[model samples]
Target: MATGFYTHPDCVLHEMGEWHPECPARLQAIEDQLIAGRIDGLLERREAPLVAEADILRAHTAAHWDFLSANAPKSGYFAIDGDTVLNSHSLTAARRAAGAAVAATDAVLAGELENAFCSIRPPGHHATPGTAMGFCLLNNIAVAVRHALDVHGLQRVAIVDFDVHHGNGTEAAFAGESRVLMCSIFQHPFYPYSGTENPAPNMVNVPVPARTGGLEVREMIDLTWLPRLEEFKPQMIFISAGFDAHRDDDLGGLALTEADFSWITAQVKAVAQRHAHGRIVSCLEGGYNLSALGRSVVAHLRVLADL
Candidate 1:
């Protein structure tokens, strides 16, 4: 089966501001690169459905959902934080972003697709259950992982977050849960600097110093993440795919390149093949520089689509 490419049009309709780094153009950049690289035709594309309230509640509180929806700005933007904002279409877009993750999970587990990639966002990974931060309003990957564990009856699922910043929100969701093993590598003392502090036994969080290069990142993953993943033997693998770690992206000071992203995807792909019957679901989290983001996603998808 072809790899599933999940996305939605409403995701592009929600905008924070004209100059925000996490603009709707980020999605357009991915779309352009996919067409330019000819990877668009190699995959199965699908529109994302809006998430049900129950799905969002699997990882977030009802009050959290109620607040975001109730407080959505009708004409302008409602500031959730110094950075996170909600416009008329913000909640709708967030629902689609999260729904993409869930639908992709269902598709992968049901064998409708070998694996799936969700290209929707108001990028998720940073929003905790009760707090929305780091330009995230809803924790998309968390909702999907819970869907896999709760609805699909998967006993064990592994979450791999490779964002430049720590996935504090995702960590908050499943920190002590035995059924989930969360492995990550992020720039230390960075934004949402919380991963290094007493992580749970199931968490393998490697915090690299600023300006760390791709080779060192790979070595850390090999030394830290791989062994734990092997031991856990997850029934499904979910990736919080973020490209802001690329050297060209100024949001992060890391020195990773598109090749590094591909290498990481390949490593995760091998793990999935070995332990999860090749079932994997990936959701986009962050990647600011348009050119770098688009190129990096294409590199990652090449490995997934075997192009």
Candidate 2:
């Protein structure tokens, strides 16, 4: 089976501002790198559809949906927080971003693809059940995981978040749930300041200090994450693939490089191959530097595509 690549043109329509780090060009950068590397043939592209309202409700409250619907601006930006903002196209993009994950999940589960990658944005790991934060309107990976478990009848699933920041919202959703095991590592004392106070037994939350490199991160994952995953024997695996930890990204202090991202993907891929029959759905989370983001995504995809 080939690797499915899910994305939408409308995802580029939503923008915070001309100066915001998360911009439309982020997707374009990945496209450019793929074309430049001549690896387009390795992917099976799919357009992201509008996510069902029921799907959104599965991962978030109706009140959260109402909040976004009632407040989405007609002409300008509506600030959800000091940093998170919404415009006319923001909700549209968010829906597509989440839809990409759901679609990829369905495809992977159906055996239409061995694994998949969602390149949509308004990156989601920070959005909670009833709140949107960190430029995220919908929890894309959360929605997809719910779809995999609920609609696809999957009893066990594992989520591996390699973002630079803690996946506080993902933890908030599945902390006490045994059917889902979440393993993640992020810079400590960082944004959101979470995943450290106390974590559930099903959660393997590793908080590394700033400037931590790939070797330490890998060792930490080997010690903490792999054992839980092996015991869980998940039917499917989900990845919150964030490359902001790359040394070139100014948004984070971690010292990961493209090689680090590749290593992480390989590790996760190995686990999926062992227990999941190679079922994996990866969604984009963060990575500000365009060059680094593009290269890192390609590196990650190369492993997934085995190209």
Candidate 3:
């Protein structure tokens, strides 16, 4: 089956600011690289819809939605936290970002596609049940995972987050939910600074130090994450595909490369093939350096599409 690529133009309109690293250009960078690599034509393309209020409520509180709506400016930006901000197009773009994940889940579950990639922003995994932080307004992956379990009647699902920063909000959302197993690798003592402490049993949180590279990442996956994931035997797999760990990205301190992204995708793809009928849904999270983000996404897609 072909891989589904879900994105929306609104995603490009929600700019934090000219100086913010999470600019609208991130989406364009990914597309530019895909076209340059001659891989854009290989996948099925689809526009991401606006997610339903019910779907958004599944992962976030009504109060959170209310706050975002009330604070959405008509022309300027509203600061949600130190780094996170909401402009006029923020809500629409956030809804579409979450919507892309839900649509991708539906497509993969229906066997209309083998898997999907949601190239969206502002990146999620940092936004929590009642709070928005880390440039995220909605927990996109959490909403989709809930939809797969609650709406689709999926028994077991797994979320793999490889962002340089821990997915604190994702961990908070599914902390004790045995039906979902979250495996992650992030820089320790980094932004949000909370993954080193106690974690839920189902959470395989690996906090690698700064400057850690591909060899260590592979070892951790083989020795730690793979075992738990195999035992979990998830019915579906989701990825928080963050590329900030790339050595070229100054936003993060890890030393990962584009080759590392490809290697890790291959590993996760193998896991899906072994246990999940090759069903996977990947969402964009954090990759600030435009060039590295684009190159890394190409490598990731190449593996996901089995090219």
Candidate 4:
């Protein structure tokens, strides 16, 4: 089976501002590169449906939902936090972005697809159950994990986050949960500085120093993360694929590159093949510089699409 490319139109409609790095142009960049690279032939494309309220409730509390829906601006932008914002179309886009992950997870686990990629935003892995921060309105992957366990009856799932910034929200959601194992590497002393402290037993937090380059990433995966994941023998794997760690991106000062992204994807693919029958669902998290972001995503997706 082919990999699934999950996305939605509303994802392009939501914008924080003209100057935001998480602009709609980010989507256009990936789309243009995918077309230019002729990647369309390697995957199965599908439109993301709006996630049901029941699915959303799996990760977010009812009170949190009520606050965000009630505070959504009708005509202009409203700030959810210092870095997070909501426009008129934010709610719709948030739902669809989350739904894309849900669809990808379903497709991968149900044998409809070998693997899947969700190309939507505002990027998740930052929003917690009660708080929406770091430009994230809803924790997309967290919701997908809940759906997989609660809805699909999967026992163990692993989430691998490689964002330049720590996935504080995802960690918050599954801190004590034994069924889910989250292994991640992020820049240290960065925004939302919480991962450096005592992490949950199942959470493996690798805080790479700024400018650690791709070599360090590979070492971490080979030495720290991969072994734990293999021992866990998770039934499914989810990735928070972030490109901001690329050398060209100044967002977090990490020195990773496109080749590094491909290498990481290959590692994840191997892990899935070993433990989960090649079941994997990856979602976009962050990547700032347009040229770097486009190239990094292409490299990552090339592995996912098996091209």
Candidate 5:
């Protein structure tokens, strides 16, 4: 089966500001690169349905929903935090971004697709149960994992986050939940610097310093993430797919290249094939540099699609 691609037009309508790194153009860049690389044709495309309130509540508290709804601006932008902002279309876009994850999960588990990729954003992974930050309003990957665990009756699920910054929100949501194991690598002393300290027993958090390259990432995953994932033997695997660690992206200092993204995807895919019957749901996180983000996503997709 082809890999599933979930996205929506509303995702492009939401904008933080002209100067923000997390712009709607990021999606366009990925789409353009996919076409240019001839990778778009290998996937089954689907429009992301708006997420149900109950699904959103799986990963976030009702208070978080109420806060975003109450603060959503009617015309201009509202600042949720110093870096996160909401415009008139932000709520709708965020909902669709989350919905894409849910849809991808359903499609993957139903055997309609081998695996799926969600290309919607304001890139989630930073928003916690009650707080939205780091250019994220909803924790998309967390919501999907919860749906897989609760709604689909899956007992074991693993989340692999490789964003340049720590996935503090995702970690917080599943901290003590033994059913879920989160293995991740991120730049140390970076934004939202919190992963290097004591982590939950279920978490395999690796803090790679700046200027680290693919060799370090490979070693970390081979030595740390793979073992935890093997022992957990997850029924499904979810990825917090962030490409900001690419050398071209100055948003963070890691010097990874497109080859690294492909390597990581291959590693994750092997884990899925071994333990999860090849079930995978990947959602976009942080990737700021337009060209590199586009190219990196295509490389990752090539591995996922096995093309």
Candidate 6:
């Protein structure tokens, strides 16, 4: 089976503002790159269904769900935080954002596809169980992980986050959950700084220095992430595929190139092959520099698609 590509029109409608880096243009950039390269032909595309409330509740609290649904504006934007905002379509978009992951998870777990990619937004790695922060609103991958665990009864799942900033919300959501193994490498002293400190035992948070490039990331992957993931023997792999660490992006100071993204994808694929029957579900998290983000995603998806 081909790799699955999951997305929804609602995701594009969840705009924060014109000036926000996490604007509709990010998805447009990715689509432009895919079309320019004719990359869409390599995968099976599907529109994401809006996730049921039970799916969101699997990873987040009822209160968080209620707050997001109730607070969605009828016309203008409502700020969730200084950076995060909710517009009229925010709730619908959040549901589809999470739904893409759920669909991808189902596709991979059911052997309908070898792997899947969710290309929706409000980028989800930073949304906690009860709080939405860092431009994230629903913790998409967390919802998928929970669905895979509860609905599919998977014994183990692994999450690898390569965003420049730490996935504090994802960490917070899965802190004590032993069923999942979350590993990440992010630039230290970045926004919402918390991963460098003591995290839960299930987390392998590797904090790199500013301007750290592929070599350092590769070293961390080899020396740290791989060993833990191998021992855990995860039955599935979930990726928070963030490209903001690219040298061109101003979100953080890490300097990863497209080649680095492909290299890391290959490494993660090897681990999945070893323990998970090559079942992988990847979701977008962050990437601001349009050109770099577009190129990096092509490289990452090329690997995920096994092209």
Task: Please give the lDDT score at residue 143 for candidate 6.
Answer: 95
Per-candidate Cα lDDT values, in order, are 0.94, 0.93, 0.95, 0.91, 0.93, 0.92
Of candidates 4 and 2, the better by lDDT: 2
Per-residue CA lDDT of model 6 for 1-307, tens digit only, reads 7888888888999888898899888888999898887887888998999998899998999999888888888999899889999999988998999999998898888899999988889999889999999999999999999999999998889999999989998898888799999999999888878897778999999998898999888988999999999999999999999999999999889999999999999999999999999999999999999999888888999998878
The residue-by-residue lDDT of candidate 3 on 25-80, one tens digit each, is 99999999999999999999999999999999999999999999999999988999
Could you tell me the lDDT of residue 141 within candidate 4?
Answer: 96
Clashes of each: 0, 0, 0, 0, 0, 0
Writing each residue's lDDT as its tens digit, candidate 2 over 215-280 gives: 999899899999989999999999999899998999999999988888889989999999999999
TM-score for all models, in order of appearance:
0.99, 0.99, 0.99, 0.99, 0.99, 0.98
Q: Candidate 6: worst 10 consecutive residues by lDDT? A: 189-198
**Pairs with steric clashes in candidate 1:** none
- Over 4 Å off in model 1, which ranges? none
Per-residue CA lDDT of model 5 for 43-70, tens digit only, reads 9999999999999999999999999999
Candidate 5 has a TM-score of: 0.99
Clashing pairs in 4: none
What local lDDT score does residue 150 receive in model 1, on the 0 to 100 scale?
94
Model 4, position 278: C-alpha lDDT score: 93
Could you give candidate 4's per-residue lDDT for residues 1-307 as a string of tens digits?
Answer: 8989888889999999887889999888888888887896677999998999999999999998898999999989999877799999999999999999999898888899999989999899999999899989999999999999999999999999999999999999999999999999999889878798889999999998888989878998899998999999999999999899999987888999999999999998999999899999999999988888888888998998789
